[model samples]
Target: MKLLAGAMLSAILLYLVLLLIPGYPPVGEIPFYRDAGFSVIAHRGGRGLVPGNTIEAAENAVDIGSDIVEIDVHMTTDNVLVVRHDAVIDTTTNGSGAIANMELSDIQAYDAGFHEIDYPEASWEIPLTVPSLDSLFTALPNHRYLIELKPTTLPPADALCELILEHQLQNQVVVGSFHSSVLQYFRRSCPSIPTSLGKSEITLFVLLERIKLGHLFNSPGYSIQVPIKYKGFNILTPEFIILAHNLNMRVDVWTINDPKEMKVVSNWGVDGVITDRPDIAISLRERLSFL
Candidate 1:
């Protein structure tokens, strides 16, 4: 009994020592994060304001003073990267086919102005064509962007890297993807560009936070962009925000449109809020400044 008791005490001491150890140093400089403050990231270029991922949507988002326009990308049949949120374009556009199966010209031929359910206020009288990432970047040359890669059979890391480098947007864009393999591949192909936490990384982070060992969590990603809550568990706790800031990482919650929720998250000191309503978020930021 005495031997067992001694072993237990030693294990407890080791655990306490580990808890006292400091975490890894801050991650390397994320150019997109440089000089940034309380970013108002437009979700799908402010889908609530207009047809998502279209040129009009992006323009309106910028006009409303959004800090960063978050978009999704999918590769077309002709090896072109287009700004879109899904592999199938049926929902967002009037088209009805997989993006991978259609060429850029084919996809652009269809009307992308199909926000009947989401944005009835936005105009859809004229046809809005889907845009290529190249064109989007050209139109908004100086803007910051958070581009997410939707799942694709063909790996698009090399193509994406080439495009970013070609346009000299290495410092203005951050890549995001749910697939760990995609993010891992992008990191390997283009280490210069910053990325967000992948699925596995987020899981590990939340687990650590739950176990009270969040200080040890480390990754090369520039930020954590999570929903306010996931699967019925609260994620935006005060402790979570403080821990992320302590590690020099920013935490940005997504898809928050309610005015009350916006005020709550902003009060929690999140780095950014990804929302479908850029106008609302930008306005809230103004009010927060006064407070």
Candidate 2:
């Protein structure tokens, strides 16, 4: 009990130390994490409508008229990049264990749609299995992928780069990682691909934005991807959007599915939105225009 208390106190101290640090923390600084789309990005390949991050979900995103599809990728024990959101396979798949501990074959054998099978809104016609990054690239050559290297773990950046290069998808895909190190390393290996600002970078940018220090907008990544409300604070404002656009950067809000909120952000001139229901967003976009 004493040991647990000591660990908790240490964690609090670390948190306080981080809070006290000023002038851009090391994780926020990405000199080359530099610079996509002005349309909807299907979050987890429209997870609301289909199984998340599977081949079927991606296809559905394209069919639903999502301008771009977003999916999470993780590296397996065999060092192969496969599409799965949660770090552990237990939540989304029939099998249990971390993706890092499971080999490619092991991951493939598990049913990726286990959780969603019982959900009435989800589609079951598509037999869901873990998809390889390579297969996704090949399957949806026409649609762009917003590859999210999840913060749960640092996936193999080099291996991802190799696949991106091999598939000739440098321009067709954009990547983002909340972890600054992953984005930095991936950018170093594949500079042509665009990445979004990390969490630290986003915090700094938001601070600069709120202070009206537009000149201090030195975003490390090509674009800024954020939630509409980060911990109850509405970060997606007109001024922030203007600032990003002024710097030749794009602002995309994630996981927005509400029609009213979509209209609000669209009117604010946000470059894009990441949504679980791309169909709804697409409909909203169409209604916004005067035909």
Candidate 3:
């Protein structure tokens, strides 16, 4: 009876230990990919505080100690690749019409900064200009960049890849796109640069599918940027981060601006975050000792 009771106790302890352990996919086996120091990537060069994708924004992000400055690229009608968020200039710029429909010379004619207001009733206008990718690279050569390739009518993905290579900026850049075709093209042509797939549709089915098959199709080195909330599961949950880490893939959630949410996500051990408020994110990182 004594021996049987001892055996039962041992079984109970083992069960509790197993329950505490996390679950991950079977193919998730890259040992060296431990969570490094958390990296803060400023989305659209910290759009919350400055004109997005502009030189001023990039400079501000860097000044605040962001690990990387993110920017979007779209080619003009004349095939000049410029940094702007939208395919059209109507929203963020003073200019009108699709960016691809306008020549670089035409785009340069407008005052890109005229429409911007720092605060309501403040009425302070900062002069802004859309910068070429080359100009951005030149301005912040030492800083890393997360370049999102905007799908446009001009300057194909191949041409963009060529420009990156010609500038020898491959090592300092991580290219991403919502278009999987662009990612596939980069995978095939510019294999050296790291790539990430943006998460647009967040569903349980898609998350599970990506977990199971992402490595097979997306290459082993690729990462996924998912939302903090997906299919009723908060991505900042320990289970989610462990699952992603085990898969040899880094998880980056986008547009997370709240300091509390940033703390929660960082505590959960997400590898990185893309935020429009780099200043806020950096402050949160310091407060939480997430760095």
Best by TM-score: 1
Q: State the RMSD for candidate 2.
A: 8.4
Please give the distance, in angstroms, between residue 39's alpha carbon in candidate 2 and its true position after superposition.
0.4
Model 3 CA lDDT for position 44: 85
Task: Compare candidates 1 and 3 on lDDT and give the better one.
Answer: 1
Off by over 4 Å in 3: 1-36, 116-124, 152-154, 198-206, 209-221, 230-237
lDDT of 3 by residue, 165-279 (tens): 8778777777777776566676688776677654432234245554443222323334667777656866545765665566666777777888887877787788888988888
- Assess every candidate by TM-score: 0.92, 0.83, 0.77
Candidate 3 clashing pairs, residues 3+ apart or interchain = none
* Model 2, span 38-79: residue lDDT tens: 588898888888887888888988987888888888888888
**What is the Cα root-mean-square deviation between model 1 and the actual structure?**
2.4
What tens-digit string does per-residue lDDT give for candidate 1 at 1-291? 999999999989987987999877777767789879889999989988887787788899999899899999999888899998888888867779999889999998888886564355655767888899999999989989999988644367778889999999999999988888889889988988888888888888888888788888987688989997889988778888887887788889998988789888888889898989989888877876721
lDDT of each: 0.85, 0.78, 0.70
How much is the lDDT of residue 260 in candidate 3? 80
Higher-scoring candidate on TM-score, 2 or 3: 2
| Candidate 2 wrongly placed segments (more than 4 Å) | 1-37, 117-120, 123-126, 151-155
Query: What TM-score does model 2 achieve against the real structure?
Result: 0.83
TM-score of model 1 relative to the true fold?
A: 0.92
Better of 2 and 3 by lDDT: 2
lDDT of prediction 3: 0.70
